[model samples]
Target: KEVKKEIRNKVDAKDVNVLLDTKADVDEVNRALVDLNGQLNLKASMMDITATLQEQALLNTTLVAELCLGRWIWKSLRTKQGGLVPWNLQTANSDPSNLVWERDRTHIVCATPGLYELSIGFFSRRRPLVKVLVNSEPVLTVNTPPQGVTHHAGGRVSQSGRYTNSSVTGLTHHDFLALPAKAKVSLLYEGDDD
Candidate 1:
């Protein structure tokens, strides 16, 4: 029957030359081959970059680890009340116990600053409603979501550019800090297993 002939044709094409005899299938195979080649090139480039990073770290392991683990960076807000409340940029504070206040004036003092991406999160009870006030500028009232991630425990910015409200209207002073004289910062280990 026709089905038997078709099956035989498909099984017989054990090589590309046989597939090329069927022009349509040959074109499909060629397209797949092109995609695979492109993927291989990208993988090769990534491997090169990763190897470079590894070699550089090995050259300066102590300095690299100190930079990664010893710094505490934050964004600060100057308040009309004449003080500041520093917020950690790495962690998104959700008022874990209904303690995060909105409409409450909070001020922060910057320990160090270098073009920080500032943002505010608006939450009602437990859900994040919006994020506003990004890019060092403060807002009187937050009417939109913050520029970065929302409800993203990971602290990512949202794709849809939103800025939570902030009152960073008259704040100033941003600087960086180096550990104090003879300061020895070490990572505490509960056990060597860590």
Candidate 2:
């Protein structure tokens, strides 16, 4: 009974609202659905925020497991050496590439064999370059490309705290997904075990 109640409570509120508004005008109803869907997406995103904070705490402890890490979000292109490379990050609306988000420690799965570089950082307007060795090939490189502004931007690396631009540092092994048997992948943020 308790579990059923919990499941019902977890149902998306917008879905219920949409069902209630089923008799509304077609175009108006569609607009309302879109707005409600946006709100629902926001609610779902809040889970990621909470998960990130909780993950930061769990990482403080010595326990390691996969669920501790959130799901994989996105990946970038590989470098000339077959390493993955990173591009300047831009906020959803802003142009000229200002503001950065942190990369999840266990983010990115190598679906194929190649060198890959990951750039992890946070909300700095300035772009800083940091090179991380992927597969011990010095394959990945993080750089801020120069523009008409005449100079490079700030660095991407965060010096302190669990939250960097968007990524949570100090990850545990639990944060990573299980790789295939022949995966050339390595954990970007090695847990205490490393």
Candidate 3:
């Protein structure tokens, strides 16, 4: 009876309640720790993505511009003076970070000085000579040959047949040219017919 009384004194109702409350507190603390770890991992992933974007922005420093002729351009008359081709459409302009294009004029102005790839394409029903010019100086020229042939029969023994050419011709030129800041570039066309 004495031993039993000592055990009862040591583990009373209040002590048992206190032990249960302590276990509950430990479980709540564990859940909070788990949530905090998940949030830290998400923050780390976000930081990595931001760093990658910054690196890509630094590596991609090129500026590009593209101009195109309007529809029904083939119906226009051609000139032999090699005049500047009027581009009525702008397919792409610079990224605004490094270049600017004049929408009203036939010039593409560079904001950053670097080597740029210039490409020009000309399509015409007659054989045409296309020139890519930088600051009024011709850098590249493309001459498209006539496409079709027409045969004419002749009675003369020396001249049996005569061939005439007719068809649409296309010419393209690609050049890697270096330009300083504020340089102007344009395309010139010379042909007999549109």
Candidate 4:
């Protein structure tokens, strides 16, 4: 009861009202939780709840449930080796964030220049090699069954579309790479040019 009063005092009335609602959106509740972060001493359980519900909300969509999330890769949407991967973005952060999917629906335009990480997870029978291209030129590429990679000086890779096998990512030891502001980035599979 004392803790509840403390929270009510620290947070604004609108946020407090949003908090008391039993049917508030999970994302909205998460926002309230974020507002409380560091404002007062709270139980570890509160932090645990915040972590567990991070960026997720309840869904009642039937088609998504039918697809089972990961099994719906559209083979037809997979473009040729040299072309931009025809991506079908499903969900994104509801809150305004630093990165955004470009209007073209083919690139993720980075708004700020900084080290960034992008993960591409997919299952394909053919080649698993993929490339991360910045503005039409490749940044990171490696050999098949890649041995190792040394990031070229000035942090640029050849534009010829050479890419490494996906497994090589684990061996690289780095989590993020230098990305330029307004960099239009996309992935491409090292598929047959024929």
Candidate 5:
């Protein structure tokens, strides 16, 4: 009985009501804080996912091309010479994207700017020096050694085959070049003796 009397004296009805109100306010504020934290976490996760997806989309934008000078022969040439050689540019066979062959099919025009890996090959009677040119400037060269035999069976005959060896030599070159948008690429041939 005495303890109950002391407790009632220390905490009156009004004091108990005020304490309860303060506790309710604290509980409500805690709940709101928790809700706000959850929302912030969700937003951060969504932003991370969006950034990852954007990076993947950028990576998917790829451009590739393959070209060859198929069976095109240039005869009766002397001295160190280099020029843009025509390529057998069948769009179906070449499978080019973000790039286009010019009207003459001697050069490739880039539609997008990025790093491109170019692989070029040439086959001719003599092992001609192959060069990859960007905007009419030679950036890479490959001097392939003669592959096949040079045959002279009969006397010097006035013919293309007689002057230029008939044996075909293959030359291939690969280069990773950084090109800007609308850049032009071409294959230049040199070292052909008639």
Candidate 6:
């Protein structure tokens, strides 16, 4: 009779409540699993974005480095050895195959055919008839800012010859020319002081 009483309680409210509690626990676990999956997905998206940003940054840096090619700078030139400049600036001679330094003492031979920007700086109070020559031919002659002022498109001049606080007598001539392949470019700073 005692065993029968214990078996009847199994179908009563006390044991029935235990089954309901198990169902609630399972429901909570399902909700937690969904939240954890969402977190994983968010982490994956952030990683992808970070990877794409790194790739883009690398591409931009390479582009800037290429654009900096074919640039040259020479400073403190007291005398002209045939007016031929060996650009100490590394960017000018970045491509050794294209920019030939030892081929000719006065010229840089360009092996590629494309539009090139050439800049030549000199100190002359009179703007002494400076020009660009490609393959021994004149292409463009530069102009200066009025009588005693720095030009708008001129570079910063460090040597003495500052006529005024805002004016510099130095000239930075800039010209863009389409040069043919294997064409030699040189300068002519040959003029007497009058």
- Candidate 2 local lDDT, residue 75: 39
Kindly indicate the candidate among 2 and 5 with the higher lDDT.
5
Ranking by lDDT: 6, 5, 3, 4, 2, 1
- Please report the candidate that would top TM-score against the real structure: 3
Q: lDDT: which candidate is best? A: 6
RMSD for each model, in Å, please? 19.8, 24.8, 11.2, 23.1, 14.4, 8.9
Candidate 5 lDDT over residue span 6-79, tens digit each: 98779678887888877757778899999999898766577788999988876654322333221222322322
C-alpha positional error of residue 23 in candidate 6 after TM-score superposition, expressed in Å: 14
Per model, how many backbone clashes are there? 20, 20, 0, 1, 0, 0
| Tens digit per residue, CA lDDT, model 3, 1-194 | 99988997787899889888777577788999999998987675767889998887766632123321122132234332447765454555436444455444555656656677765556445446777777878877777433463322221233334513333335555668788777776667776453
TM-score of 1: 0.20
Candidate 4 lDDT over 70-137, as tens digits, reads: 11122354574466675564355331244565333566666667666555543333334667788988
TM-score attained by model 4: 0.41
- In candidate 2, how many Å is residue 159 off? 24
In model 5, which runs have C-alpha deviations exceeding 4 angstroms? 1-82, 91-97, 145-169, 191-194
Indicate the worst ten consecutive residues by lDDT in candidate 6: 160-169
TM-score: model 2 vs. ground truth: 0.21
Compared with the true structure, what per-residue lDDT tens digits does model 1 show for residues 1-194?
99988877874536767766767677798999999999987675777889999988887865433343212223332222322233333343322221222222232222222222333332222232121222223323333333553442333333534534322121122222333222221111111110
Q: Write the per-residue lDDT of candidate 2 for residues 54-100, one digit (tens) a residue.
A: 98888854332321222223234222233233332323322111112
lDDT for 74 in candidate 2 is: 24
Task: Write down the lDDT of every candidate, Cα atoms only.
Answer: 0.35, 0.39, 0.58, 0.53, 0.61, 0.63
Give the number of colliding residue pairs in candidate 3. Answer: 0
